[model samples]
Target: MKRISLCLLLTSFVITPFVQASNTESASLDHAQVTYVQATQSQNGSWCFNTQVHHNDQGWKHYADAWQVLDLQGNVLGERKLLHPHDNEQPFTRSLCNVQIKPDLQKVVIRAKCNDHGWGDKTVTVNLLSETGKGFKVTRNNK
Candidate 1:
C-alpha cells in the first residue's frame, strides 16, 4: 500500500508540469484570423477598407494588434493599427480610408496580425471588379 501511494504521487508530479506546458503552448498557437472585409471606392479613386478580425486576446500580452490591405503581389496598400487589446470583443471591425489603389488592380487581400503570433495564415480577399467574394463586400461610388 505504501509503494502504490508513493508511485501515484510521483506520477502526478511528473505529469502536472507537462500538462501545464502543453496548455500554454496550444493557447499561444491561436493566431488572429481575418473573418470579413468590406472595401469601398470613392469618387476620388481612393479606397476604404473595413476589416473584421477574430482572436483569443489574452489582454495586452497577446492580442490582434493590426491588419493590412495588400495587393495581389503582397504590397501593402493600407494598414489599420490597433492601439489597445479588445479583451471583451471576440471579433472586432476596424477601418482604413483614403488608401490609394491602382486602377488596374482588381483585388486586394486582407490579413490580421496578433502581438504574439505576428501574422496569421487565414486571409480574406476582396474583389474590386465583380464586387463579390467570400467573406467580403465591395462597393464603388462614382458620385
Candidate 2:
C-alpha cells in the first residue's frame, strides 16, 4: 500500500506540469490573430487572397473560425469560413477566391476571427493597384 501510494504521488508530480502546460497552451487560443495576407489578381480581373491565421485552436470549441475581406468603409466584400479546427495546423493559410474588386476600389482589409474570441483587433490591408499593376504582383501584408 505504501509503495503504491508513493508511486502514484511520483507519477502525479511528473504529469502535473505537463498537464498544466497543455492547459496554458490551449487557453492561449482564446484570441485568434491574422499574421499575413497575400493578394493577387486573376486573369479575369477577379481578386483572390491567401491569408495566414494563427490560433491555438482547441478543437471546435475555440479556433480561428473565419476570415473576411472588407473595403475601407468596413463593408464585407468576401468571407471565408473555416469549417473546422486546425489544431494540428497552427498558422495556416487559406484562400478566398473569385472575389470581385470594383475598379474604383484601391484597397481592402483582411480580418480574422475566432469562435470564442470573436474578431481580432489586428487587420491586414492590401493595395489593389500595386498588386494588379503592369503584371500580376503578389501583395503581402504582415500584421
lDDT of each: 0.87, 0.81
Give the residue spans of candidate 1 off by over 4 A.
1-29
- What digit string (tens of lDDT, one per residue) describes model 2 on residues 21-80? 876754454677677777877777787888888888888788899999999999999999
Highest lDDT model number: 1
Task: Return the number of clashes found in candidate 2.
Answer: 0
If scored against the real structure, what TM-score would every candidate get? 0.78, 0.71
Model 2 segments more than 4 A misplaced: 1-29, 131-143
Residue 67 in candidate 2, Cα distance off native in Å: 0.4
Model 1, 1-143: lDDT tens per residue?
Answer: 99999999999999999999876654443788889988888889998888899888888999999999999899998889999998898788999999999889988899999998798877898889867789998999867
- TM-score top scorer: 1
